[model samples]
Target: MPDDVSTAGRPHIDIASVQRLAELADYVVPFAIRAICTLGVADHLVDGPLPIPDLAKRSNAEPQALLRVLRALAGKGIFTETEPGVFGLTPLAQPLRSDHPVSLREAYPLLVGDLQAWARFDYTLRTGRSSFEYVHGMGYWEYMVEHPEESKRFDGSQAAGTRVEVRTVLSAYDSWAGLNSVVDVGGGNGMFLIGLLSRLRHMRGTLFDQPHVVANAHGLLREAGLTDRCTVVGGSFFDDDVPSGADAYLLKRVLWSWADDRAHLLLSRVREAMREDSRLLIHEPVSFPGDSDEVGKAYDLILLTMGGGCARTEEELHALLGGAGFRISRVIPTPMFPLVEAVPAT
Candidate 1:
C-alpha cells in the first residue's frame, strides 16, 4: 500500500478515474503565471492592495477578465484578495517583482514564455528532434541570432539565472586559490565570471563566447571595473580554438545545451587546449544513483524540448569526460547545481 493510504483506514482515492479527473488541469498553472507576468501584475501591486477596477485600469485589461485572473491566482496562493474587490501580492508572489534582488521575473521568458514550443513537446518525443524548431522553424540558437530583440531577453534571463546559481556554487565550493588564470567557456555577458572575479580580486580571467555575446561583455566588464583583470574572447568552442594559456576552464550552466556527441566534441576541444596540469570545471544540474529525480528530470525535459541536450547522471558524465580525454576529479554539490571537476587524461 502507498504511504498515504496505509496511514488512513480507508483510501481517499479508491477510484483512479476520479483522481485523474481532478488532477487533469494541473498544466494551467504555467500559462496562468505567464498571463499575470505579461500584465506586470506584481509590479503594479508594489504599494498595496488595489480594487479590481483600479488594477485593471493600470494593466489596461478588461475589468471582468482581470478579476477572474486575480481570483484564480489567489486560489493558487500567488495573490490574496482582502474583503471582496481588493487584491494584493502573496508571499509566493514576491519573487515575481521586477526590482526584487533575487527576482525570478527574468526567468519568465524561458520558463513561461516558451510554452508555445512546449505545446508541441510530443513532437520531440516522437522524432528525437527539438520541438522548439517545429514551432519556430529554426534551432534555438539560430532563432536567437536572427532576432536580436528576443535574444536580448533570452540573454537577460540567462544572466539573471547565473546570478543566483553563481552565488550558490561559490558558497559550496572553495575559492579558486591555486588556479591563476581562468577561462569561462561559453560565458554569456561575463556575468558569472564577473561575480567570481569580483570575489577573487587577485585572479585574472577570460570570458569566451560568440562574437555577439562578447561584444556586450566589454561594457559590463568596464562598468564592474574588471576590464583590466579580465579579457573577453569571441569564438565557438567547437572550433577547438579556446583562448590559450589559462590554467582553469569553467563551463558554468553550459554543457546541458548540447547533445552527447557535441558535448564530447566540445570537451575534447577544451582538452586539446589544456596543459597536463590544467582543470575543467562543469557547473550544471546532474543526477546521481538512488537520488530523487525532481530537478534533473524537469531540466532534461526542457533540454529535450528546446535546447537539444540532456542532464546526465554521474556515471554518464564520467564516461563523457573519459571519452573526451579527461578524468573526473570529484563532484561538488550545491543548492542549484553541481561542480564536476576534471583533469586531462593524456
Candidate 2:
C-alpha cells in the first residue's frame, strides 16, 4: 500500500509484483547453491577464477549446464564473472566449501534432497502433525534410524554448528562451572561434550542419545582424548529414564524436535530423575516477538515439516516447562540462542 499503489489500481505495482516473484522463486537460490556444492564447483574455484571448460572438467559436470547455473548464481552475488565464461567463488560461496570450519556442504543436501518430506509440507499446515511421517509413513526419528548415513550427515551438519553454539552457551552461562558431572541429553557425537570438557577439565560428561548415534561417539571421544571422564550412553529420551544423580542435565537444541506433548514427556523424564539440587539447562533458539529474520523463520519451518517441532516463545516454553515440573529461573540470551535454566519444581 504505497502512495503510488492505487485501489483505482488496475493491477499491483511493478515493484510489488516483482517482489512477489522473487519470493515465489526463492527456491531457485538455494537450489543453485546446492548445485554448486554438489558439483564441487567452489572447490575448483578455490585457487582462482577459471574458464567454464576448466570448471566443468574439474567438477566432472556438463560445461554448458555448469556455465548456465554458475551465471545464474553469479547474478545472486554467490560467484563472480570477472571475465565472460570465467567464474570464481565470492565470499558467500566460500562457506559452502567442504573445508570451511562451519561448512554447509552437507546441509545443502537437506534442502534439496529431501523431496518426500518437503512434498508433504502442506500436510503440516493442514494437520499440525509431522509432514515427514505423513509422507514417509514413519516418524522423523524412526526414519533416521532406518537411514544411518543420513543420520551421520545430519549429525555432522549440526556438529558443524556446535563450534559456534558451544562458545555462545559457555560464555552466556556459568552454571556448568565447578560441576562434577553433566548429562547431555540428545547430544550428537559428543561435539558439544568435547568443547565443554575441553574448557572445563574438572567436569565429567555423559552424552545420551539414540543407540546408533551414541554408538559412534566412543571413537570421537577417544580421538579427542576425552575417554577418561566423558562417556556415551545410548537410549531414547521418550522411552527410558534419564540417568540420575547428575549435577545438571543439558538438553541442547532438543525440545524443538517434537510437539508440546512429546516435548513435555521428554522434559518430565529428566524431571523424574532430578535431585532437589540438580539443575537443568535447555538450549532454545527462541523466536522472539516481531522477529522476522528469514533463516530463523525457515528453521522453524524445517522443524515443523520434519517433526512437528517449533521454536517457541518464552511464554509458550514457560507453560510447557511448568507442566513438566520445572521452573525457569532465568533465560540467558546470547546472540546465538537462549540458555534456559530450570530447577526442579517445589
Candidate 3:
C-alpha cells in the first residue's frame, strides 16, 4: 500500500471541507422558510399537526410539494413530521405566526423580498453600484413607491423595529424627557413619532416624508390619539425645506440609505432648519470598532447593494456631523443602535 493511502488503501476524507459544503447547501432553508411564510403554512399548523393534503388545501400549496417542504424543514428542526404525511410546528416556528408576540411574518418577506436583486449582488461588488437598480431598472425607494403592496410590507416590518427603538430611546436617552417638540425628518408612516408622542404626552412632533408616505401617517397618528399633538407634512426632504425651529429634529433610521454626498445634503437641510436652541438627534445603526458589530456590518452590505449607502462608524458620524455644521453634545449607546445628540455649530 502507498504511504499516503489508508490501511485499506482508500483515500482520506476531509470532514471539515465536507461540513463546509453542507453549510453552503443549507442556503435552501431560507427560500424554503420564505415559501412557507408566503403560503401561510405555519398559520394553519398553529392549532395542531395536520395531514399533508389538508395542510396543502388550507395553504394553497401542492400536496406533494408541501410534504417535501415540511420534511426538509423538520430535518432542520423548524417543523416536525409527526407521522408519515402529517406535520406540526416546532417552538422555533412560532415566531413565523402572524399573531405571535414577536412575529417575524412581515420581516421575513422584507428580508427576502429582493430575491432577484440579490442574484445581481455580485454586479454591485464589481461596479460599486446598486444591484437593485441593475435587477429592477429602478432605485429601491422608487420601486417601493411604484409597488404599493411591497411598500406596505416594508412599513409593517419597520413598525416592528420602530417599537424596539422607541423603548430603547425612552430608557437610554434622558434628553427626550425635557424636549417639548421634535420634528421627524424622513419619518416612515410616523411610527417612531407615534410611539414617542404617546409616551411623552407633554411633547409634540412633526412627521415629514414623501406625500404618499405621509398620507398613511395621518391615520396612524390619529389612531395613537396623537392627532392634536403631531403634525404630518408631505414633501421630499432634499427638495423641500424641513420643518423649522423645533426643540429637536430627529433623523431616525434615515441616513444609512444614501451615499456621503446625499447624506451630507440631508444633514445640511436639517441643519438649516435648526435654530440655535434646537438639538439634532440622529438615531441610526452605527458600526462600532470591532468584530462584535456583525448586524451592523450585514446592514451595511444591504445598503451597499440595495442602494449606494453604508453604515457609518462613530468617527464617520463625527466627521459627517462636523461637516454639516453641528457639534456632538453626547452619544447615548443602546442595544438597538446609538443615539447621537448634536447642537448647531456656531
The number of the candidate with the highest TM-score is: 1
Could you tell me how far off, in angstroms, the CA of residue 50 lies in candidate 3 after the best superposition? 4.2
TM-score of each candidate structure, all chains considered together = 0.84, 0.83, 0.80
**Between candidates 2 and 3, the lDDT winner:** 3
Which ten residues in a row are the worst by lDDT in model 3?
Answer: 104-113
| Deviation from native of the Cα of residue 76 in model 2, angstroms | 1.8
Clashing pairs in 2: none
Tell me the tens digit of each residue's lDDT in model 3 across 1-346. Answer: 6645687778667788778899776768988887788888889988999999899999999999989988998998999989999999999898788887546666666344377788888999999888999888888878988888987777777766777778888899987777999999999788888888988999989999999878888788768888999999999989999999899999997888777899999999999998899999888878887668545667778788888567898888889889999989988888787889999988
With a 3 Å backbone cut-off (N, CA, C), the pairs that clash in candidate 3 are none
Residue lDDT tens for model 2, 60-175:
99999988998898998889998999998889888777887656676565532256888777888999887788778887767777888877766666766787777888888876
lDDT of 1: 0.83
What is every candidate's alpha-carbon RMSD to the true fold?
Answer: 3.8, 3.3, 5.0
What is the RMSD of candidate 3? 5.0
Please give the lDDT score for candidate 3: 0.85
Q: Tens digit of lDDT per residue, candidate 1, span 1-346? A: 7644646576656577676776664766666776777678889999999999999999888999888888888987998998698999989998788887667777766443366788888898999888898898888878777878778777767766877876777788784788788999999788889998887887899999989868989999999999899998899999749987688999987787777899999998898778899999999878666656456667777788886677888999999899999999988887777888999885
Using lDDT, give the best candidate's number: 3
Which stretches in model 1 have alpha-carbon errors above 4 Å?
1-25, 110-113, 145-149, 177-180, 275-277, 288-291
